[model samples]
Target: MLTTLSRIVKSGWLNFWRNRWLSSSAISIMGLTIFVTTSLLLINVLTNSLVQILRDKIDISVYFNLETTEEQILETRKSLIDLEEVESVEYVSQEEALEKFEEKHQDNQLLMQSIQELDDNPLEASLNIKAGTASQYEQIVDFLNGSQYKEIIDKINYRQNQAVIARLSSITAVLQRSGVVVSIILALMAVLITFNTIRLAIYSSREEINVMKLVGAGHWHIRGPFIVEGAFYGLVAAVIVLIIFYPVLWLLSPKMTAFLPGSDLFYFFRINFWQILLLQIAVGVSLGVASSLVAIRRYLRD
Candidate 1:
């Protein structure tokens, strides 16, 4: 068995080296396909991360009437927190709000003068409500509006920002659907390309294959070399892709960070290296092996 395996490996390597250009052509195609798939996967991951960041930033600020007591606000917070979708609720007193505004506009002398001229903190105490998902924000807002303390609840700022949130949600939905459709189409195209490449390679060796069949060689003996050849192509393409992608990402990381401040593109890619590697290898190997197997099956059955 070992001897037969060694012979198959040797033959596959010899054939690959002898027809270097053809083999390289197939590998190049596989490499490009893998690169596109990997890029899409990376984009999807980044989009999800960005969407989560946006969702986290989407909060409903429930302003309390100036006369509303701290105890009443605390009770309202507790009630909001009891909702299963509620991730967190924070209370910001009027004084704290004023301080925050002042800190934010410290450079604006005109704004500073206006704030200083106020007899007292005109801002109302508010609760910042966060939900687990963007879709849940409306439900929380509805609950707040229907609550007994609704009178003391000066306003729910959710309505003010509804249009922006709705647009973001729509965009995210379209992105997810488009990602799935594109991935499927790309995967099918890759499979077809690989299959055709394997068929061409097998056609070139048709005479030799027929001669072996006539000599009464076992099925495994006939199939082994082709399988190994396919695997070799897959491995070679995967290695090429990894080599190219690593440096490309490294070069682009800084630019990505610059475009999206606080983005962890470099760190995210580094952390997901193993997953990406495995995915690339899987796609490469599956394409190569499945294509070879299908291409050879018809000849073998004959």
Candidate 2:
């Protein structure tokens, strides 16, 4: 068994080396396909990160009446935290709110003077409620509108930001679906191109194949080399992609960081280097082997 496997591998390598030019095109295309696949994976990661950042920014700010007490606000926060849809409920005291307002308007002298002139803090205590998902915001707002808390509650800001949240949800869904679809389409194109290249290889080696069949060689013995050749294409392409990715990501990292401030593409690549390499190799080799198997089917039937 081991000898047969070695022979198949050796023959596959010979075939690959013999038709290096043909293999070159296949490898190039396979590399491009893998590159695109990696790009899409990274893009999806970035999209999810951006989405989470947006989600973190958004939350239901329930401002309480100026007369509302700390105890009442704490009770309301506890109630909100108990709800299944609510992820968290953070209570902001009036003093904290006043401090934040002043810090935000410190550059504005008129606003600074107006705040100093006030006898007491006019800022209201508020509860910032974050939900598990965008759709849950409405339910949370409804919960806050309950009669028990209605008198002390000044207003819920969810309604004001409802449209923006809804749009964000829609956009996220669309982007995820679109990424999957585009990946599949590109993969299929890679397979088809590799299949055709392998078919041409089989055609070029037809005379040798016939001689092997005349000697009563088994079907797998005949097909194994082609399969190995396909895998070689994938393997080489994966390596090329891995090498190309390093420089590309290194260059883009600083630029992307400049544009998005906190985004570090190079750092992300470095952290996931091994995982990315494995994924690229797996995808490249699978596409190659699958394409070769399908391509040689017609010839093998004889």
Model 2 TM? 0.92
Tens digits of lDDT, candidate 1, 1-302: 89999998898888878889989988988887788888878777777776676777778899999999999999999998999999999999988999999999999999999979989888899999888877788899888888898899888898998988787777767777888888888877877787898889888888888999999988888888888788788888988898888888888879977865567666777898888888888888888888888888878987
C-alpha RMSD between model 2 and the true structure = 2.0
- List the global CA lDDT of all models: 0.85, 0.85
Candidate 2, residues 62-137, lDDT tens digits: the string is: 9999999999999888888899999988889999999999889999999999999999899999999888877789
Give candidate 1 misplaced runs (Cα > 4 Å). 105-120
Ten residues in sequence with the least summed lDDT for candidate 1: 257-266
What is the Cα-based lDDT of residue 185 in candidate 2?
A: 88
Model 1 residue 156 lDDT score: 85
TM-score of each: 0.90, 0.92
Local lDDT at 189 for model 2: 76
